[model samples]
Target: MALPASSFPTLLFFLFLISHPRCEAAESFSHYCSYNRPTTPAISKSIAKVLSALVSKNPPKRLNTVSFGGGKSKVFGLAQCHRDINATECKSCIEDATAQLPHLCPGQADAGAWFDHCFVAYDHERVPEQHGTGF
Candidate 1:
């Protein structure tokens, strides 16, 4: 059986907020956790915390981004907490999404997720276009 996908407009806001890669910086109005491996242990830990909450079913519903180590060209990701999700629920959804990505993508280093809604993947391509977001 196949699962259906959903989109949260909040994600667009998340994307809009993004600029360069500032793994160390965070915003109060948003919840962004990133893992910058090969350096920045603090960042990795921050990311882990968010991931843990996500899988546990307590997602922030504002989990806007999940970026991997940029040094790994094939590694990068983006996930949005469900708009309707409360902080706790959003965390949970993202955790599940994060865990499944590696297995689902297998070998592919780059993957993006639409929490409780969609998951997009690409390697040599930019972020995958969301439904009706246009390709």
Candidate 2:
């Protein structure tokens, strides 16, 4: 069947829409989880608690760091959500990161993970405070 020229533009538009695949938002991009030997059960638990708290307290796409427990059991945690995403996305990403990291690096004393929407790290030893600009 022959179609009128006026319908050509509409047909072209529809073809463009269907032919182009929708660019899906990524659930995760890449991750880095340390492979250090397992820590004491107390320290592991503390680290888990800190990570849970971080995801629960998702800020306005802001970076947050906290330390909990004490002595050898102390765990320092850091979480940062991509500023470009909304609060909801930020929270979701952080939650996923926190939940998966522990299992991904079981019994590890230091671990870090990065997703498309957020980044998280938990460790028994805190990074040393840099005295000068040397890296």
Question: Where in model 1 is the C-alpha error above 4 Å?
Answer: 1-63, 70-74, 112-135
Q: Model 2: per-residue lDDT, tens digit, 1-135?
A: 999999999999999999886753334445555665578989988887899888878865367787889998998888887667888787877888888888768788787776777777887888312122121
Q: How many backbone clashes does candidate 1 have?
A: 20
Residue lDDT tens for model 1, 11-97: 666786795454431112212222222323443443344344335433333424333334434232345553544665445445556
- For model 1, what is the error of residue 104's alpha carbon versus the real structure, in angstroms, after optimal superposition? 1.2
Off by over 4 Å in 2: 1-28, 127-135
Report how far residue 127 has shifted in candidate 2, in Å.
Answer: 5.1
Overlapping backbone residue pairs in candidate 2 total 1
Q: What is the TM-score of each candidate against the true structure?
A: 0.41, 0.70
